[model samples]
Target: MFRGEHIGELVGNPGPARDAFPIEADTYERLDDEFYAGRIETLTASEQDLLLATAACTYPPLETADIRQRSAKSDGNINVLMGRLTEQGVLYRVQKGQYEYTAPKFHEHLIRRTGSLPR
Candidate 1:
């Protein structure tokens, strides 16, 4: 025969985890601005064009082929750009050969800055 144990004993106190990682309200906006600036600075002209084109679209989770058309980039180049954006957390892969902005607001930000998608 075996004895059962309380879940709390096994898991310990959950409250402590929350306490240890308390949110910092003040730094968030500053940090976000710094991060966005850094990321934009790192992109090449072609990559910036691709990102802006994708961001201008109203529909999301665009297929790789569709994005390639919109961005007017070669298939190989689009693959490379998508891989880099995915690594940077600026894009999210929704499924095989499909992706979308990591956050919709980020797309809106690009649209506001660029005023329109690239031809």
Candidate 2:
């Protein structure tokens, strides 16, 4: 954490006289991806919250119990909602009975639909 006044001291030499510097090409490219190419279709607040909650959990494979505890939604409702989210490519069926974030895997699909990658 170099402060404005400590930049020269920290570097053990005089710092650049110019205050503004251009970003490296790779860094600028990453910014472009995040700002434009990485944007996903806007999700409803509820869906976004669900995704975050799922990410927080460590339980092997999410079960109705997990939803009941974290989301407090009815068992049947959770099941139905999970199915819909998976079908929508927002969630991935990792195994016969497990799931993972499909964000990285289904990013292509999301990009195709929304014309941008998912955040």
lDDT values, one for every candidate: 0.68, 0.52
Tell me, by lDDT, which candidate is best. Answer: 1
Give residue 90's error in model 1 in angstroms. Answer: 1.2
TM-score, one value per model: 0.59, 0.45
lDDT of 2 by residue, 10-118 (tens): 4443455332234455554564466433423355555554544553344445454555566766667667667766876666676654666554423333333335322
lDDT for 82 (candidate 1) = 85
Off by over 4 Å in 1: 1-35, 117-119
Q: After superposition, how far is residue 85 of candidate 2 from its true place, in Å?
A: 1.0
Best by TM-score: 1
**Span of 10 residues, lowest total lDDT, candidate 1:** 1-10
List the candidate 2 regions with Cα displacement exceeding 4 Å: 1-41, 59-64, 105-119
